[model samples]
Target: MPVHRSGSGTTRRSRLAALGTLLAALSLLLTLPGAATAADSPTAAAKKPARGSATMGMGVIAHDGRGGLPGGTLVAQTEGVDVSSHQGNVNWATLWNSGVRWAYTKATEGTYYTNPYFAQQYNGSYNVGMIRGAYHFATPDTTSGATQANYFVDHGGGWSKDGKTLPGVLDIEWNPYGAQCYGKTQAGMVSWIRDFVNTYKARTGRDAVIYTATSWWTTCTGNNAGFGTTNPLWVARYDTTVGTLPAGWGYYTMWQYTSSGPYVGDHNHFNGALDRVQALANG
Candidate 1:
């Protein structure tokens, strides 16, 4: 009886010690920073963008939590559009007929993916008498900004003194395939962008336009205003108004106001009139 009682006591003590350890672990876990919330979780999965697949405004239109009014209609500026591989060979004549005076076509992404339809879209838009530029869908995670910029320059992203070609654009926004901001800290993102911009200016003799959403700019770059003086801002907002711009930008050079055009791609507006579009192209 004595031995049995001793065994029972030992078993109870062992359970109590285990329980104490579990409680201590639970306490530590509760106190730890960055416990996963739904907000921190990867976005409810959509069709993740494949390599060479991401286009202009893909992330902003897909995962930008802010809801833009559906079937949105607002008109009052110089009309424009952006295209990529997704649009295939765009009907530039049709877009021209619809009054789109300026356009941007996706040129390269990271250092690997160049838009297969680039030649058609880039040349087609310019041939149709539209002021067109090429944009790089930046993948800072895949390569350094300078490497991607070099790839972009070698591809269709190069600028010329021609009156029809606008400077290239850097489309930096949410990551469709992974974490927001491509997992970079604000300082790191700013550095990556700096490398691309400096390299692009060296190669092309023009500062690249920066395309982004205000929400993305705040979250990724901590609303860094450093680029405002150098890069033209192509602010994307699919609402009735352009809404608030990111810090440092006194005005948006272009506004991607909606993706609900009657034709193929998203519609945009130059901040000024048709002559102003020519001015940008001239520079």
Candidate 2:
């Protein structure tokens, strides 16, 4: 499970401190022109839509309920939320009105489980002008990584560089089952992750973002640095501070700060400027 419930007792001021750090880092990244945008592949232009004049912004407001930003500025960082079937019939417009600007809806799990609410959640968010993406709950032990990746892609988990569509994410965290590591050895787990990511790239032409915790990664993959250079790390640390990241990652691409946030579900942060978040959507 994510550290969502661990830091409920953390003070709001402490949380603000953490947010300050994130905002500063993101502001610095924004200064470097084209720093956040990755080089496009040969086929990228054909698949990605033309950039629009309006840029999307995901806002994380203070506790005042007035939607005020961290430093009273609008473009510091992007805010988003991730949802699953558990959050049924989301009032996406209401969420947009409440400062959420992007979303990642759960699409599939293993090869059998698919979120029935995926279309509504994913499309609804996009219809309302929110950048949207889909994620797959990986079950590497149940099947081969390539097989699961294909299943995920076939079932609404593929990505298009449509300026507002983010690349798919692989939610590889603790198994609700008894075996947290999915019954695989350290080396086996690394191999499975590589296979899944490779197949996902071939199918979607975008690197699949990885969502996990440091402790889980260390225990399961022996702190493997294999995905560090290629895949973006979406670290889940629900404390007032982000803990030490998994090995080989100098910084996180996204952070799941809290599940019990002001929003409807797990609240996340895109660790860069508004354009950077939109850049990911462009593949």
Candidate 3:
């Protein structure tokens, strides 16, 4: 844009005054409390996801809530719940009394975050006589799956065959923090997941459970079916039915039925009875 510059005194003075006023306004904006600066710009803010701030099934309700309430018979299904730092310290007694027989707590996210409330949520569930496990929120963009798995294990994603501790879960769903598939292609996503689950198994001598929503799985791995054999599936669908699962899994080991389920956190159901939950824990 070309500006017409005049040699006339009045025009020059007017231009100088206008420039001074603009600078003063900018200075005022900078001094204002809570004002947005370059560092707080929307574009700058979107680049970084808070480390260690995610939980299990974080994206399910938002992405796949179209399932429309849980449907079918829950008769023999075991009741469970999954919690994260968002739930803070859980009241396990309330959950247990509500017939929640199993539970999972967020253990770690990528290699950067470990749940601060892990001990309380994990141990409290066990002490209350509920079979419990831990889950790792996968951030495939930040680190290799193996590194994350080790971090998860080091933090809290360990297993014990005490008939009370279920295997850790790998939460590889919609990336709430960044790219939909962590900016990876379907094949790349699969390999990353493979690395994480493999490393988790190698470190703990137990297969890691994989938690995901069907839509994300389909979009991310093109609905890859390779993991159904070794890892147990924990499918999330916030509706009346469990709905369609990802390509590889024949059955879901656990179903996260509703984020609005009774009691605390997101409620879930083991595919079978209490003994089945115990069996997974024992393994």
Cα-based TM-score, every candidate: 0.80, 0.73, 0.83
Off by over 4 Å in 1: 1-47, 65-76
Superpose all Cα atoms of candidate 1 onto the true structure and report the RMSD in Å to 1 decimal: 8.4
Better of 2 and 3 by lDDT: 3
Candidate ranking (TM-score, best to worst): 3, 1, 2
Off by over 4 Å in 3: 1-49, 66-68
Clashing pairs in 1: none
Number of the top-ranking candidate, with TM-score as the measure: 3
**TM-score, structure 2 vs. true:** 0.73
Q: Write the residue-wise lDDT of candidate 2 on 1-283 in tens digits.
A: 3465556546666889999999999889877876654443455555432321100111111211122223333335678898887788789988899888889998888887778788899999999999999888887778999999999899998887679999988888766543678899999999999999999999989999998887788889999987888999998776656669999899888887776777587787788877888988896
Tens-place lDDT digits, model 3, residues 152-215: 9999899887889999999988887778899999999999999998999999999999999889
- Against the reference, the lDDT scores of all candidates come to 0.88, 0.78, 0.87
Sort by lDDT, top down from the best? 1, 3, 2
Clashes in predicted model 1:
0
- lDDT of model 3 at residue 100? 90
- What lDDT score goes with residue 6 in model 1? 100
Residue 164's lDDT within candidate 3 is 94
lDDT of 3 at 92: 94
Shift of residue 266 alpha carbon in model 2, Å: 0.5
Q: Give me the displacement of residue 211 in model 2, in angstroms.
A: 0.4
